[model samples]
Target: MKSSILLLAAAATLSAQIDRIEGERIRPHVKFLSSDLLEGRGVGARGGQLAAEYIAAQFAAAGLKPGGENGTYFQRVPLRSVEVEPGGALTATAGGKSISFKWLDDFVATSHTQEPTGQFDAEAVFVGHGIVAPEYQWDDYKGVDVKGKVVVLFTNEPPSTDANFFKGKALTYYGRWTYKYEEAARQGAVAAIIIHTTPTASYGWQVLRANGRAQPQVRRAAGEPALTLAAWVTTDAGAQLLGLAGRTVEEMLQASDKRGFKAMPLGKIHVAGKFNFKLQDIETVNVAGVVPGSDPKLSSEAVLYSAHWDHLGIGQPVNGDPIYNGAIDNATGCGLLIEMARAWSSMEPKPLRSGWFVAVAAEESGLLGSRYFADHPMLPAAQIAANLNFDSFSPYGRVKDAIMTGADRTSFFALVQSVAERHRLSIKPDGHPESGGYYRSDHYSFARVGIPAFSINMGGEYEGRPSDYAAQKAKEEGSTYHQPSDEYKASWDFSGMEQFARFGLALGIEIGNLEKIPPRVDAK
Candidate 1:
């Protein structure tokens, strides 16, 4: 009874501390970070550098020591951008009928600079989902001759009503667009285009077009063995292409609902596109700072907190707006980090294990900044405790549950849940696990190297709202997610953000003090 009373008192005290995360305090940071002056924090843009400088300033103010290479808070990432523009019309001849697809309206094409000009007159095959998972006995490419041909693939894995099939409603790696592209490359396909639908891809064609229309793909090098072109098309395009096979897109979609599906050929099809690519080398910086551990022995070991600060800069305008503010997408995340650093700096008891705040760059293009850091970390990979990545935090009311994207993949996830539970908040796996949210962020960059990683967002059960209100709100946000409408608004409620800030800070502290290293996957 005495111990229970003590626990209650502790909970009350902790709740009070969490309540200290004032919206007024976090508002200015979000405003400044998401301001138009920053131009969406695009890679290699002036706004991106400004964002880096701003984060470095916040780190300094928080009293964190520089943990970057040498004596600086900046780790320079050698980056490059490739702009693939439509040189001419994108023409496709199929079923003895030739038609052209509009570059921005119907299809988006990306190609390498190695080929100044080229054409691929290859056979077209509809490879459902482009997946070949031996474990699931699912092979979309099995018994198919795709070599030197252009393949058409689906955006996500096949639907499954059975738990045994592709994790049921939960999307796996096989469902990711990246996986589809990789599979195409491995199959010796000249090029591949994944068909997109709002329901399947979780976002509208506007996102795909906005991402590919004017946005330059960030590439590391002028590499070779490249596909003639890697592309994406709207559902209408898929319908037209499949129509040549005397088949309907819906029929193919239904056929791909589960196991035992075969690839079908669209006869006499030749896909060709003219791509104009201008490549340039650029430098972006990842801002990192360290709150050194109080214990000398544990000072060398560090826990990582990361947020990507880059977004799509100036893209094709919508209603005269082109700046991708990325306010909720990441400004909120960076704001949370700043608040966390502030809370930690003034705490009476410092964390036993060191904590590093990393604001990465080129997250929109890829996880470039985190990738570079992982390759060249100040501390050895083995000594790093864990990674907590923040991205696209909602600014609504307090939520009943914390949604962690990658939490389920590692044993350390239990520790995170425990910390939140102590604060009277429940934690759950990502509601949209089908989106491959686990692998989409910076934490995964660290996780790939064997470190336990977590990417957390606040959602599920909003206060003073319906039980499923969070899910509905998520759907509403999906429409404007990557569009120019992603600007910051003063009307946003910060109650949920405050809850997340407190929760994350407490979780970090708990993980920081633990002597046991975060669990790693054991190799047999």
Candidate 2:
């Protein structure tokens, strides 16, 4: 009996030692990936490729098999980079008179295809709020066939005073710019331009320019007619365009938000100047590896873990520092990936289901890398069990909580909650759903395709702090989020990271060993 107790004590000590080593293993890799040498891991840059190779090397060292096609760790993603020529102009003609506006100052446009050039010479119609929600009994496209015409759209949903309309102040998927563009395409419209307002868009025109300037990603599919062009006009510019048609922007928006609104033609025609396109063909890669299950029967099933490895890359200097090191935004996430792989690799009996670690690129570019992977997955999407994604780790010391975004939408919540409770941490829903952060990350692409994917994040929220205070802390940290000042600071406390890594590993183990796959919440 005495010898058996000593053996048990020794086993526990060994387990603790392994955990400590796994924690240490992740730190160096995180430091290297986010170092100035990596140049923010920008897509299409050497640094981005370097980051991919680094992840592949770590995956290989973790004893995982290449899960990508052709027996390699990389799945090459074909991307087209189209930059719009500056100084392009849009001219609207009405009443036999015309008005012209310059790009950037008044509007912007780009294609989802690799077309070097395109044009739209169509009539203009105003579509109220541009939303068609059967549940809300609001159909802006009612009785309007906008085929081959330009459709103008208001930015957000209706006001709360109209109870029967769209969720008043709440922004739905219909309010998103992506939805606006898609709805226009579905209506067979030749072009779409969204009217931007500070309140509705949640940012200024400069922010629009900053986001719009980047090369957008579209799933590379053949024979699809990419929309000719899409643009966002400032409220002032929108008003000017409306004035050309003898109408006020305010009156139009008010009419738009009300129930039973109709699509009205502005009776104005616009001709945009020839757009010179700047095209660069580039390839970004997703790094992926697999650890086969020890059970031969269960090896066919796989669990996926993903974290984006790219940030803003090298950009405009902030405080004379040029590298957007992204130490927290994702470097820590990449670190956690490595640590999780190590923990699984060292398991005594290994896991029942195979594990895949995918370090994706271009997440900063709107989940492009993951989008490509989900569209062209190495394993069948159905065969995969679940996906766990990490973006940033809490920089605040240790936390008693693990915040799960999109929690109620899936049964994975229970799994995560169980693990959190075991670790003396609470599971809470994301506080800022209005930001659409759930749809903004890499996991969103997978979730859209019927794969159960979730993103777990650490919080600065303390036990006694109010939700507003916690949100402020998140904002303060996010201010340095995309800036060059994101370099890893020596003052960062790694204790919280240890708990985070352990929690992630435990969650993976539970999922890998589970008999049934977690299902999506029916309500969502």
Best by lDDT: 1
The lDDT of model 2 is 0.76
lDDT of 2 by residue, 1-524 (tens): 99999979955744563474344566787789889889888888888889999999988887888877689999998877766766555777787888787667787667665567767777889997888889987799999888988888876676664434443343566777778887888788877888888777766775555444446465447866456777788888888888878888889988997777999888765645456567777888999988888878877888889999988776546568767788888999999888788777767677789888899888887788998889899888887778888888865566777777655466787777877787788886565444456677888788878778888788656555565665776577655656776778666667677778787777777788777776554323
lDDT of 1 by residue, 1-524 (tens): 99999989866755555566666678888999999999988888999899999999999998998877689999988865666755655667865787677776888766643344546777788898899988788999989999888898788888765668777777877888877877887788888988888888988888888776333344525443457677888999878877766777788888876578998787666776666665667888989988888889997888888899888888888889988888988999999888887777666557788888899888776687888888887678888888889898777778888788777777777787788786667886666767767667888788888888888788677878998786787687656788888878888998778778888887777788788775587210
| lDDT, model 1 | 0.79
Candidate 1 — worst ten consecutive residues by lDDT sum? 213-222
Clashes by residue pair, model 1: 171-434
Report lDDT per candidate.
0.79, 0.76
Which residue runs does candidate 2 get wrong by more than 4 Å?
A: 1-27, 91-108, 155-172, 202-206, 212-216, 219-222, 239-254, 267-273, 314-325, 463-478, 481-485, 518-524
Local lDDT at 417 for model 1: 73
Q: Against the true structure, whose TM-score is highest?
A: 1
